[model samples]
Target: MLKIEGLNVYSDNKKILENINLEFEYGKLYLIFGASGSGKTTLAKAILNDESLKKEGKIFLDNIDITNEKTENTSNIYFILFRILLK
Candidate 1:
């Protein structure tokens, strides 16, 4: 299971996602959909540990604490994101 606690994102002193708590069960497909600038990408970036944005949260992968872990630390958990283009 993947869980996020107390997730917060700030950009230019403005809050994007605040106090976000989410959990994802293992062996299931998940999708994130939102309107434009709804912080969907920001949330994904935070999960991937992108350093560009200031974030505060605890990320757990299968009950393992990965809050301070980098994106290179991989241990069986994987994410497959599919972005379809409507032409």
Candidate 2:
């Protein structure tokens, strides 16, 4: 199971995400959707441990603290982003 507790993300002293909490269970499918500029990408970046953004709180994968873990280390986890192109 993957869990997030009190997750907050900040960019250049500006708060992008505040006090967010989420959980994902094994063998389950989840979706995150929102309007543009609603911090959706920021949340994904935080989960992937992006160093460019400042983050607070804890991210856990099966009871392990992965808040600061490198993405390379978590080979089993995958993140997919889809973009729509309009002509």
Candidate 3:
């Protein structure tokens, strides 16, 4: 299971994700949906420890802490983003 506990995110001195907690089970498909600029991608980036925002929390991979730490090969949890062009 992938668990995020007490997650809070900040960017440019503004709050993004606040005290958010989530759990994702293995072998199950999940979706993170929201309107534009609602921190959907930000949450995904934070899980992968992206270098664009600041976060405070603990992320667990099967109950192992993986927060702010370098992971050897964390390809198990993956994310894909789709975009549509309107003319």
RMSD of each: 5.4, 6.1, 6.9
Which candidate number has the best lDDT? 2
Q: Write down the TM-score of every candidate.
A: 0.77, 0.83, 0.77
lDDT of 3: 0.73
TM-score, candidate number 2: 0.83
Q: List model 1 lDDT by residue over 1-87, tens digit each.
A: 778999999877789999999987655557789899999988877777777778888888768887767766532234332211111
Note the residue pairs that clash in candidate 2: none
Worst 10 residues of 2 by lDDT: 78-87
User: Model 2, which residues run further than 4 Å from truth?
Assistant: 79-87
Candidate 3, 1-87: lDDT as tens digits: 778999998888688999989987766667889899998988877887875678898888778787775423343434221111111
Q: Which has the better TM-score: candidate 2, or candidate 3? A: 2
Q: Give all candidates' CA lDDT scores.
A: 0.74, 0.80, 0.73
Residue 56 in candidate 1, Cα distance off native in Å: 1.6
In candidate 2, what are the lDDT values of residues 1-87, reduced to their tens digit?
A: 778999999999899999999987765667889999999999988888888899999999779998999866653354321111111
